[model samples]
Target: MPAITAENPLALPRVAASPDRAAARPVLAVTTAPSGLEGEGFPVRRAFAGITYDYLDPFIMMDQMGEVDYEAGEPKGTPWHPHRGFETVTYIIDGTFVHQDSHGGGGIITDGDTQWMTAGSGLLHIESPPEELVMSGGLFHGLQLWVNLPARDKMIVPKYQDIRGGTVKLLASQDGGGLLRLIAGDLGGHAGPGATHTPITMIHASVSPGAEVTLPWRADFNALAYGLAGSGSAGAERRPFRMGQSVVFGDGESLTIRADAAQDSRSANFEVVLLGGLPIREPMAHYGPFVMNSHAELAQAFDDFQAGRLGTIPAGAA
Candidate 1:
C-alpha cells in the first residue's frame, strides 16, 4: 500500500452511474439529523453529520451551528483534540474558528471561510471555542464533516486547506438563478481551489425559492444534500423537506431539486452541501478520534502517538 503524503495522496474515485443502476427505484431516504447533547461540557446539536453510506460514503458525522457571539477574548469553539485516519472539513457560515494543530497547519475559519484538514496518520489539533452560541438570542449555524481515508493512506501526515469565501469559484445554474461552489472537484465547468487527493466533490449551492436544479449522478457513488435554509422537495416522490433536514439520493442518473416558495416568508434562499464519492466497502473500526480497519491498526495509531512516529508539530498561530 502507498503511504499517505503529498505525492501518494489518498482519495476515493468517482464513477458515473450505469444505465442499469440508474433505472433502480428512486428512494428518497430521509434520515432525521441527530442533535448533539451535553458532551465534554459542550452542548451541541447534530443535524446532518454521521457515518452512513446511505448518506455520504467514506464520510462520517456532520455538525452544525446557526450563529454565535463571542465575548471579547473568550474561547467559543472546540479545544485541542487528537485524530487519526480521517479528514475534517469546517465550513463557517457565521462567526470564526480560531484553529491550530500539531502538524504544521493552522488558521482561522471566519464567516464564509472553509478549513479542510487531513489527519492521515495522526495529529493533535483544536478548534478555538466561540463565546456565545445563543446570542441575545440568535442561533449559530455552520457545518463540520468527517471524511475517512482509505486503508492504504491512513498513516499519512496532517495538512490544512483554509479556503476563503470569495476565493472559492462559483458556477451558475442552468437558469442563472442559483450558484454553486465546487470545493473539491469539478462540477460541470466549476472547480474549487482546495487541493484534493480523492476523486471527490464537495459543493455548496444557493438556490432561490421555486427554482429547480438538476445534477447528473451515477451509481458507483452515493449523494446527499443538507438543507441549510428554507425548505424544498426532492427525488421522484417529492417529499417535503425543511431547514435542518437532509435528503439522500440512491444510485441514479441525476438529482432534481424543487424549491418551496411557500417557505420564502421565513427564508427565500436555501443553502446546500452536496457531497458524494465512490464507496470504500472496507471494514471500519473507530475510536473517539481515530478510524482504522481493525483493532490492531487503532492500537498501532495510539502506540505511534505515544512513541512520536507520526510527524512534526505545528508552528505559531497566524
Candidate 2:
C-alpha cells in the first residue's frame, strides 16, 4: 500500500470540511467487487460490476489490478487493444507499469504515479510490466478507471498526461489522522494535477486505525468510496466495508469514513479510493472497448477499428 508517504503527515497542509452545519452523506449501498483475471491473466476486481450505471454516471468501469505477489517470471499484462469515447486513468500504488498508445502518448508510471490517457476519437494501446519488474516478479497493485466523455468531447483530439507521484497534492485530515492524496480533479479549493474532459475528483486516503476522515465535496458530483487495502466504516451511520468492497453515498455536502479500531495484518492503515464525478446523464451503448452514444456509433467504431483507421503499432515496437 505504498501509494506515497510523508515523513510527518501533521506537517502537511490540513483540510477540513464544514463540520458545523454540513450534512454527512448517508451510505446508500455497499457492494463487493468480484475477483477475476484481466489483461493476460492478471488478477483483478471489477469495482463497479454489480452497481447500476446510474450511480456511476460519467464513469464507465474500474479494475483493481492485483494486490498479489507474483513469482519471478510470472507477471503479465494486457496486449495491444483499441478504445474510444473515454479516458483511462491508471494509478499505480505499489508497482510499475509501461503504457504506450498509437497516438504517441505513453510513459512509465510507478508507485504513487499516474498516467492519464484520453482515447477521444480512438487509439490502439498496450499496458505491461517493465522488463525488470517482470524478471524480478514482485508485488503489483494499482487501479485503472474508465471515465466517459460526453457526446461533444467523444470525437475530440486525443491526449495524455504523465502525472508524477511528487506532483500529487497531499493534504492531512483536520485532526492529522489521515493522509489524503488528491490524484485528479478538485477538492475544496485545491486542485489535482490531472486534467480531465469531465469534472471528477479522485483521492487515495490512508487513515490510521481508529481515525476518522471527513471531506468537503461538490454537491452535484456523485460520491463513491472503495476499499483498497483494509477495513473501514463509511458514512454517518457507520456502515462497515472492507477490501474489494465499494460504498455509495447519498446526496450530501460532505463524506465521512472511519478506520476500524483494529485493522488486518496485511496492511497497517485503512486505504480507500474516494471518487466523485458530475453525471453525464446520457444514454450509453457499450461493447468491449468502445463506449458510444448509440449502437450505430458503436458499429462505426468497430468498422473503423477493423479498417485500421483507429491507429497502428509503431514500427519495431517493443
Candidate 3:
C-alpha cells in the first residue's frame, strides 16, 4: 500500500440499499455561471449569492475556488478579515490551507479536509496557503460556503470544527460503482463529523460508470448539486450535466445520481457536492464579511471590528 498523506486514504465501504426504496426527486432547474477573482486575487465561482440567497435559504454563498496552479513564490489568498452573525465552511480538495482566527482558533486543512467556523458573535481570521506550499509551488482547489444563522442565534458564541480527510465518513454504492463522502450531514446511514447550528447536509459523491445511487433527503429542504468533475444525470429529470453546472432539485424525499460510462473509459466517473438545509426565511442584511438581520446590526458589526472589539491575530502568527 502507498503512504497516506493528508489527502484521502480511507477505503470507503460499500452500502447496500433495500430494494423497496422510494422514487427519486426531479430536477427543477440548472444554473451555470463564471467564476471571478476575489479575496486578494484568488479565482472563485459563486454558486449562490446576493438575491439568490432567497432561493437557496440558509445558504448565504457557495464559492468554487477555481483550480489554479500557483508557481513558486506566488502570493494569493484571503488576508485578515472580520466576520459576524454567520458561518464559513472551507472544504479543501487539492491543497493546503492555513487558517488563524482572533479567538485563538487555528489549524491547517490539507486535501480532502474541511474547516467549519462559526463567526457567531464576531471574529478576525485569515486563510492562505502555507508558506511552504507558496515557496515550493503547488495546485490549489476548494470551495468556501457561507451559511446564514437564524435571527435568534446570530450572536451565539464563536466556534470551530476542523475535520481531517480520513475522519470524514465515506460510503460506497450498493453495487460498488460509486462513493459518497458525508461531510456535514447523514448519508447512507453514516453521519458526518461536524456539528451544525443550522440543520443542513453537505455531501461529496463520485459515481463509477453505469452505477447509480439513491440518497434520501428531507422533502422540506431546498437542495442543489454542483458538478465537480465529469458528466452525468441527476434526479428524475435525468438531465445531462457537464462540469461546472449547478442543478437545483424540486421537492422530493430522495435523489438519484448516475455516471455516463460512454463519455470516456478513464473519465466515466461523475463527481458532485450536494448541499441543502431548512430555509431560514428571515430578513438578512449582508455587508462584506458581516451577515445580520438588520442594517443597524450590520453597522454595529462594522463599528465593533473597527474598534478592535472583534479581537485580532497575534503578531507574526500568519
Position 154, candidate 1: lDDT: 82
For model 2, the run of ten residues with the poorest summed lDDT: 15-24
Arranged by TM-score with the best first, the candidates are: 2, 3, 1
Each prediction's TM-score against the native? 0.81, 0.98, 0.90
- Each prediction's Cα lDDT score? 0.66, 0.92, 0.80
Best by TM-score: 2
Could you tally the backbone clashes for each prediction?
28, 0, 0
RMSD each, Å: 8.0, 0.9, 3.2
Candidate 1 deviant stretches above 4 angstroms: 1-25, 37-43, 48-51, 68-75, 129-140, 264-266, 306-318
Off by over 4 Å in 2: none
> Which has the greatest lDDT?
2
Off by over 4 Å in 3: 1-23, 49-51, 262-268
Question: Deviation in angstroms for 102 in model 3?
Answer: 1.2
Q: How would you encode candidate 2's per-residue C-alpha lDDT over 1-318 as one tens digit per residue?
A: 775888799998988897675788899999999999998999999999888999999888999998989899988999999999999999999889998988787889999999998898999999999999889999999999999999999998888889999999998999999999999998878899989889999999999999999999888999999999899899889999999999999998899999999999999999999999999999899999999999999999999999999999988776
Q: In terms of TM-score, how similar is model 2 to the real structure?
A: 0.98
Worst 10 residues of 1 by lDDT: 1-10
